[model samples]
Target: MGPEWAILGATSVSLVLGAVVGLLAIRLQGIYFAMSTLALAQMVYFYCVQASFTNGEDGIQGIPRGVAFGVWDLSTDLSMYYFVLLVCGAALLAIARLVHSPFGRIVAAVRDSEPRATSLGYNVSRYKLAVFVISAGMAGLAGAVKAIATQIASLSDVSWHMSGELLLMVLVGGLGTISGPLAGALVLIGMATYMSELREWVTVVQGLVFVVVVLSLRAGVVGSLSGLMRRRLQAAPRVSAASLPGASAHTSGAG
Candidate 1:
């Protein structure tokens, strides 16, 4: 079936489920939360395995690259790429705007200090739920696009290994920085693609890279750069202030 409408419907359902899951998971912290999420994902994977609609292990393949909105034809590679690019661009812009908004500030506050945010009368749970829903929706959107691009929908997308890989990308890129994921994906994906023949060594090499990054760039590549920039900025103001006092004293002495 070339029904692109299913993509939107699936995304919406996934987002709602994400919010519901977040509401339930919001109470758990640290390892407990991680385990709960992992369990839920595993359950979904089993369900997919049993579900007839998902076509069992074979998955839903041969998905036709039909026209988007019944207007723009995405059957061609160039057109499909541009369509995906537009969607990704819009998502990035939306995320940037969200992070700069008051709501985003509240979410950040909750992340840094839930107790403090709660004391300030903000429902931290709700904030987490909203953020979870947004993240889920974005993920679903990406998956949908990937399915369309590859002309298949497989269980690999929902696998635990995929989750681990995603976490690795975020950690290597920079947890809080917007550009971190992009850079990490570029580097890691490029490495994986190039080293596809050396499959056995790839994992070991990636692990070594992770160890090096953790030992040296604890804040992550982007985060470390951001910290350096901040320090330089602070130093600049101090240097200017010191120079101002010295210049004034020298002028007074000259007078």
Candidate 2:
């Protein structure tokens, strides 16, 4: 199958699997839910490491960048990069739109106060499960894209460490914000790439950054900036049209 087909297949499979997992996972709350997911991820990692189809520890390598959409040759790095860029741009726009939609508002309400959401006749459990399934599908799609781009798939991808890294990205960027994940990913990846020579000290830097952000900016970088701008806008003095220099003169003249 081509890259497109592979992506579609991965999404479909993940959606189904996510639903199955969410059935039990969504019932747990807070730390229990996180631990449950971590355990599940560890199981998947072990399976990937032992499964013959996954090629054990070595992983599947030399994956071809099959033609995408029959129009674009994804074999070339330039073409592949542009394709990934377009996909990312579209995904970001979709996420923004989704977050502003009524459904998104309802989800937010559920997140803020589950009891209130339930009192309002919303199915909190269903919404949570739906979100989990959707997120899983999106993750699968991203994995497919990454596999195609890098021409390999590794067992480590299914490990809990990857999940921790993903969580770090969201927290660093701004949890519950639309653009936070992207910003976090870019920053973390940039740090890793540029500071490769720092060796084990790179992790120390990441830890320091995370700690500082948590202590100083509780809302995260983008979230804090957004809140600051909002406060400033509200604090700014408002100029009523009636208070203008010509307003009274014009009114008197009209009268």
Give the CA lDDT, 0 to 100, for residue 206 in model 1. Answer: 82
On residues 1-255, what C-alpha lDDT tens digit does candidate 2 reach at each position?
678898889889999989999998999999999999889888888888888988998899999998888878998999999989987898788888888999899999999999999999999999999899989988888898898999999887888878988999889989889888888899888998999999889888998999998898888788988999999999999999899999999999999
List model 1 lDDT by residue over 1-255, tens digit each: 433686787689889989888888878999999999999989889999999988988999998889888788988999999988888888889999999999989999998999999999998888888988898898888888888988999988888988888888888888898888877777788889999999879988888888888889897788888999999987784456437757888877889
lDDT of each: 0.86, 0.90
Best by lDDT: 2
Off by over 4 Å in 1: 1-4, 237-250, 253-255
TM-score of each: 0.91, 0.94
Best by TM-score: 2
Worst 10 residues of 2 by lDDT: 155-164
**Candidate 1 — what's its lDDT?**
0.86
